[model samples]
Target: MSDPILRLEGIHTDIAQYHILHGVDLEVPRGAVTMLLGRNGVGKTTTLRTVIGHWQARAGRILFDGAEITGAKTPDRARMGIGYVPEDMGIFSDLTVEENMTLAAATGPLDPARRDRIFEAFPPLRTFWRSPAGTLSGGQKQMLTIARAMAEERRLYLIDEPTKGLAPAIVSTMAGALRDLKRQGASILLVEQNFAVAKALGDYAAVMDDGRIVWAGEMQELATDAGLQERLMGLSMEAQ
Candidate 1:
């Protein structure tokens, strides 16, 4: 296999006086979706923030495509081809969907081909092109945020809990969009708690506990092993 597109080695982060992430080691292989799985408050989100420079790493190194980016600024990281969608789905409430997408383009105008691809992935984006982002439903807002990240080409995407609080139908739509991205060979580091979504989209899975990775394996293996799921994520059969 090729070298991972994103790697975190012994990463530690602190929020105020509290230590949130303790020595996290993770890898997201090229062209694969690596699921960062854990219960709430286990530092999964902190790890993503550290990677994208929203939270500085107190220690350890972050590598993107073999270059050390531990000290890189957030904009530098984004310029280096890291796309991020935070848990809050950072959309401009007053802006139209088109305006929000235009702002996300790294270079000049959005590439026509990329715009078509994004529309294909989330057709609602096309339907609500001129609508205020705030006027859209929760699911449409989520789609807009994801589409904004895809407005231009990106080497890696750091997405946090995208399906949170959405209806099952919307979750399925989001999952299908991610699946299309996977087919298009996009590399993603996804932090998700919904086991169903994880099982649907993860190529590899890493389970975190108290700021440390406790298990790493194939997604299918983790999905089928209910006992392991129960122990690692406190998941019940129904949850799976």
Candidate 2:
């Protein structure tokens, strides 16, 4: 197999003396979708933030496309083809959908072909192209956020909970968009809490507990191993 597009080894992070990520290790292979699963506060978001250089890691190393990026600045990483969409979706309420996308395109030249491809994958965004991002529904804003990242033509995309707080219908739509991105040969590192959604879209899955990965394997294997899911992800049918 080719070297991974992104990898984190022994990543330890501190948020003003409060340790968050504890020796977290993960990888997103080139052109594949990797899911990071964990309960709330288990460092999944922190891991993505650290990888994007928002929260500097106190220890360990992060590599992107075979170059060490542990110390890379946030803007430097963005220029190196890493795009991040946080749980809040990160869309500017004051900006129109098109404006938000144009801002993200600042990272790289916008390819008309790719822009059309993104629109083809997410027709809703095209419909709301002139509307303010804040005026859109939760799902529409989420699509715009991910679409903005796509506009950058980045090699890897880190998305935190793209499906959170949306209707089931919209979640399924976003899932299809993710599949389109995968088909376009873009690598994705998804931090998602919905087990069903994660298992549906991710090729590989890692379960994190207490800031440490407790299990990592093919998505099918993780989905089938109910015992491991319960132990690592705190999943239960009764709760669902």
Model 1 error, position 123 (Å) = 1.2
Q: Write model 2 residue lDDT over 116-221, tens digit each, in one string.
A: 8888878888898888889998788888888988886678999999998989998988999899888878899998878789878989888888888888888888
Worst 10 residues of 1 by lDDT: 231-240
Candidate 2 residue-wise lDDT at 60: 96
What is candidate 1's CA lDDT for residue 42? 94
Per-residue lDDT for 32-89 in model 1, tens only? Answer: 9999988889998999999999999999999999999999999999999899999899
Q: Each model's C-alpha lDDT?
A: 0.90, 0.86
Strongest candidate by lDDT: 1
Worst 10 residues of 2 by lDDT: 231-240
Candidate 1 residues lying further than 4 Å off, grouped into runs, are none
